[model samples]
Target: MVRTIRHRTMTTNSSKTPSSHATRQQNSNKLSRTKKACFGLMTTVLGLVAIELTLALLGVGRSNADGDPMMGFSKQVPLLERYVDEDGKAWMRTAENKLVWFNDQRFPLTKPANTQRIFCLGGSTTFGRPYDDNTSFAGWLREWLPHVDASSRYEVFNAGGVSYASYRVAAVMEELANHEPDLFIVYTGQNEFLERRTYADFFEQTKAQLWLTGLVSQTRTYAAIDSILRKNAPQESDADSIVLAAEVDERLNHTVGPSDYVRDDEWSDKVREHFKFNIRRMIHIARSANAKILFVVPASNEKDCSPFKPDSEDGSFETGQRSFDAGDFASARAAFQLAIDRDICPLRAPSNFAQFIRDLPESDDVRVLDFESELRNVCIDEHGHDILGEEYFLDHVHPTIDAHRQLSRWLISEMREAGWMAADSIALNELSAETVEGVDQSILGRIDRTAQGIAMRNLAKVMHWAGRFEVAAPRARDAIELLDGDAESQFILADCLRWTGQIDEAVVEFEKGVSAYPTYFRGVQRYGLLLLELGDNDAAREMFSIATLGWPETDPRHWAARFQLSIAHLGACDFESAHRELQECREHTPGDMDVVFAIAEASVGIGEPEKAIELYEQVLDEFPNDVDTHLNLAHTLLSTKQTDRAAGHFATALSLAPDNERAQAGMMVIDQLKQSAE
Candidate 1:
């Protein structure tokens, strides 16, 4: 006989039946209900599968206009599916109002026969962060290209993205194979530690999972869903929304976010390994596609800007700390320098990563542009030590706007030397130092105030991440003041206020952020969470509900809001309401293992073990490495007297998360069952 599932809080009929026939009728009704639920679930799954297949077949949601997939951090980069030229070429208008090629520039869908195309790939530095494309090194290179090679129409596309690590660049290069790229110039490695996305995590995914993620990412469904989940108030102005994108997408803001800190040597080793492999893979991909590669060694502010993360407690670092505490500034500086050189684990890449980059060129087909050395040579102090202070760098790694201009001049020289451009070109001498400096300053003047605000907020966030809260908080205020009505700056200010123990003030700023932009998820979600912390569950629920009301039905944030609301309901012992919310969340995030498990918990709460079992199984298939899913599935199987199957899952859960109390208890239960059976 199957064991009965214990329902939480819900009262059921406990009165005795009138007769045997009445009892039999009740059993038949239960069977019918179970079958109906199963059939409904199956139908939903089948329908989704059919839709996915059809969309894939039609190629309705694939590459952007430039044939690149939507970039990572999809929300930051907006897709302009709105514009299609007469030739059917899709164009993406950025938050800056510049209608650029989907990935780089708007050109013919096919490369023009008379054009010599050179593609530059990197992270925010290459993308010209805190400034527009006109001020970028790539922009400088584009103008210089025609000077050196007047015979051909030069096309230098800057294929850089904000926060794109080397692995992402590798993926882009792999896709560039079909585009007939004449030359591929890479200037990455700075962001490798920023995002730390590995090849396995970034590219190695099941075909089905990839298809689903890619399809949703490429379609406008996600944007609509994001808007809905954000509770984008219909009354919000377009200008306000545009400002939100700049603030949110500002690379400086992430100087201390998720990918900023590295704790140990093991993790550092993994990131370094991935970086090496990705760069090699990128070169191979370009070479195989018949494109010559110019790998630029990335540089940073080593002497002046403090390390984004604390150095590992190696002997040298410990000695440096001791020297500093002893008031020996000279010894301390030397020791600190040694620590930086010897520290086994650092957030930003050490000198060795640069060395590897400089050594990338081995043959005529490949060459290295040593910007790392060039920056060091020009940034030296009278004492003969390398000095990279605020004058040269905007922050820890990003260069000042002036540096970008000089970088372009250096790259031009390297191009001439590498035979990429003819040395005899009359324009080589025409690119005078005075001319480049004048151009750089001119572009700096053209930069929008809002862009300047973004740079400030980013710098503020980095300071906050570095634990200089006192410094960061005021800068955040300045950012909001600089860019009036900017919701992103307001959000950052609120974050700073919250960290500084100014709870009420934080709430006010968060409210302002949400008011400025209705569909801003960070503002809404953070505000709701703060309310929850303050014991305002009712208010939190209302906020989350309003957020989900207009959001895409399938958005992850929609499901996230529902899940949180469900938890709140569950805490209040409102099991029925909790179950309802969980069901809705599951529908929205059907592919999400967490949502699936949450629904399973709801099924268990409502005294439906079979349903819980089915949901848990689905979760397992999606996330095989998830110990909690395996543990939950084992518990469900054990409740149903499936001891043998339960034991296997229990073992898997134990293997995945050793010393887990639940898995240990589950093992004991399985052992007792085995002994009893014997």
Candidate 2:
């Protein structure tokens, strides 16, 4: 038994040994293949890295790049080219390609000996919107500094652009820094949410997202790949969540009021974070360039301007205005602040902007100016009001050109304290009417003579956009008086009056300008529609005539005006005229269903039953499920004594619209007719 067991064990061992050696050989081959695959992957990765590095060194994707994690902050250099004049002086002027939103101002690029350059940067206020930079605070400084300090030359450049948020201002600062800036005066905060932007994807402010953004934002290789992918990407881009457009399309550009805005808490938080981040980052940028920076606390016409979009449905902003009227200043301020905080369309920056600036640590290169307090003091001292309003401001946030002078004087005080440039001590008494900048007009009168009137007109226009018709109307009227009833001002006035429910007044304003400019017909057409709504057919007809008179027949407005005229004719019960106008409208818009329906209704009113029946049947053939068309055809058939056809049409109308009162009544009338015949 032992000999048999040993023989079996030796035979089993010999078979198992051959199988083990075969398995070992197979394992060795698999391991060698795995090593080759790993080597190939590492080689491919290293080769791709080398290619990326080579492309990066060649500057494949480096333009408009800031230290923007996620690359959502699009930084653009100004469209300025440096040139040397015949006098061996370098200068930089606004490029021709610069959009209409920016100013056409020029400044010296090469600094003269012992000269200090002061850059005034912000949004429309700094740009002096409604007029130009000549009326801005920087304009006051440019004129005032020359007269006050004749010892040293001071160069003040207006680098402000319209609707420029702080991030955009920082972009401008980056460009200005390259030209040897000595000091930068920033007076931003308003217009934070003026532009529309999105970061819905990869924007939860997560640690992992931030880390990836930081890594990707710094790499030229990533940007190059992104650019290639962007060119091949679909029209609806996924990269929008991590990229910002170079140009801004302001919220007020396409519509009226805050219709485009919504109550987005997350978006607001993002804006707040970006706002602070941009301003704080500017400090480092300025310090790196050995330039001093002063940030001014922005103020708004909180009491005068109603909220663009109220948070509450119960008129919280209106209630706040009523409180101010009732002499409750404390409650009024609180309400106004709340309105600003909860405003859906944040055209004006919130109070947190001021708080952020105040909280910033001050140093030799960084300082803060309290322009809000200065404006409040001015209002209380002269106007007997603690809250700033129209007395100090022209619109929501822009200070009047007169107020701009005082603001510049305060800036001079701040600059002098900081020992910047040749700024000397300036008193309120010294900046009188006879001062160098304070001539018969404000600082801007040297540029545009009609700037004040234009400012008032612009003010009225924006107020209308904000849905403050009452505030808009008076400013519009003032603009008319100053502009001598210019067509643009008259049109704006009419718009304001129409919104305020003053139909008669609006008509007068509209008519005053319609004959002068044919293009003013757009306003006339709108008012004519308004009159039609108010049942003033004669006035509407007159407006339609004005809208259509001498206009090109091929133009779309001619057909539209004719259609409106037909409606007015129908309103006056002029069936023949309505038919004629609708026929002409159909010639221009042959496929228009509205014109076809109108012609059918006009034929019925004209007592042409066969013609009306033919048109109604044509409409029924196209829209077989249309309950209104079936009801109209049934009524026409009943009028023509086609009882069977009328009954069928009524049945169809009833089926299509069971709950329709007209369809039910028509069906009942058809049943009654059939019962009477029986």
Candidate 3:
């Protein structure tokens, strides 16, 4: 209804003040200034981003030496083309670096029209350590594939690297996609912990952060920044430096020691997530490239090898050790599993990682090869234990040559189930002796004594790490004999000699070892330590100095070099030099009780009893059970006429070790002093 409305004007007298109008004007000006500042800042940021992107695309501001966006990467990649060698055997460079070859197998430039090419990817286990390529499962599979179907052609490529984890494998898969692989077999999970990333570097990355990282990882600027960052990173210890060569490639070696075992739930969560992501990405890539994929859940030696880094808070490791000592293998296996799950630094993948792998095939349209379970079952039948040990595994992760053969048998069945092989052509029973011989001739049977010895030496190192020195010594001796003066074998033999109490023989071997590998610092350092043990202080000092001279200052072993030098100086009675070296060691490793004790020993040698006492007391606070430290402290206290304190320490030492002669003598002296005073 269009009704007439009446408007009432009610204007207040207070509504139109000059002061209020001026305040309103001031507020409007402030808002305008804020908006202008915001706009200017946004414009500046956008301009900078545009400039950076432009420069990046133009290759103007490269961060890496190769004009690559990522730092520390070399642009000089090796030609990875297949070529027939003089022996008519096919070979190719597996990596861009000339260091690695495809062992004795080769492929053509293009896949044959009727042939199915399968590429296997993983770490040393897949690479077949302690065994040549012919003995690897992939190598065996290559030979076995032809026997499955005489009319159909099949080819298998062992694309495994020494320490390649999944991330590295993903890159490899991408490269091989161009080579026309019809199928891909991935057996990994153990080597994720092999990379030297910190917990924070892993878990703290958000999805957005990961997206940014993915974008940045493609740029030379990021590469340049990474190189700069690593250049300024802290040095490694002497122990790591001395033992680093035991690995196949130092470039792939872990740069830092694994973190001390802790719950580390955050790190575990991130690693699990990262592993899943990498696997999914790999699967997606393979599928996109029109290749069928098979994932093998890896097996490890749980009952044999101890946890790489045991947790301090968890008692499972101790329980497992006790069970192992008691010879209760079944119980030991369960306890060991607990330790492996809790371990912060597990070089071998725990059962949980395998569980993740087992769960993968359910959600995705891929083939699942449960090699882990089959391996365990075979091990149980052969060894009467659910978990495998040295009989099957070369170490904690690597399988024996025989184990690889067994694995190849199991994988063949899986392939058949996945319909990769012909059902009617040949059964497992039909694999003829002639086919076996040919397989042996082409791939499996060609590992020479020299190669075997090298593999043995690598294997002996794992034994040495596990404290089976007696077992390792014989293998080291065999390596030396077989290799006939190979520098690595000689050095290993010298170490074995020392461990086995052949001191004079070890000294001779050490001298020969250092001479054999003049540039290798480990032999030189070991030679010096051997000489020091034999009381040849002057020779030891010279040897230690030589060991320190040419090594990179940034190497962790630089501090270790200084530590050995200090010991040499102390042995030579060069108190001042020893003190200086100890000071340097302290700066590098402040928490090292060995360095602290060494400093105290030098103080005592120089007749600074008060300083010696102070240092000893500091050490005792941290390690009260140290018998030698207790004896030293007691003597110092007695020298200063602190009889009661000295007596207490003497008694404590005797309680710790009843056969301590020095402690016994000190106690007798204390009794005499008390009797005389009374």
Candidate closest to the true structure, highest lDDT: 2
Per-model TM-score, in order, reads 0.48, 0.76, 0.62
lDDT of each: 0.66, 0.79, 0.73
lDDT of 1 by residue, 507-623 (tens): 888878877787776567767777777777877776676666645766667667778777666655666888898777666656767767777877877888899999888877778
Per-model C-alpha RMSD: 27.5, 8.6, 11.7
Candidate 2 backbone collisions, by pair: none
RMSD of 2: 8.6
**lDDT-superior candidate, 2 or 3:** 2
Over 1-678, each residue of candidate 2 has an lDDT whose tens digit, in order, gives 999999999898987675777889989999999999999999988987897789877867643334544334443546567777899988897766664656777778768887878888998899887677777888888877765566777888887888888877887788778788889999889978988776555456776777666565556677777788868977664645655667666777777678888899998888888888789767866876789999999988787777787776646567678888998877777788778777888877788888888778887788898888888787778866677777777778888878888888788777777776454545445655677535425444576436667878888877876787766777887787777666666777787788778888887877676767556777778778878988989989988988887369988888889899999999988999999999988887887877887899899999998888888777777788988888988899999999899989888888888899988998889889889989
TM-score of 1: 0.48
User: Worst ten-residue run, lDDT, model 3?
Assistant: 65-74
- Model 3: per-residue lDDT, tens digit, 523-642? 788778878888898898888888888576678776787788889899889988898889878887899999999999888878888998999999999999999999999998998889
In model 3, the clashing pairs are: 69-219, 69-220, 70-223, 71-223, 134-443, 236-556, 237-556
What lDDT is reached at residue 567 by model 1? 66
Best model number under TM-score: 2
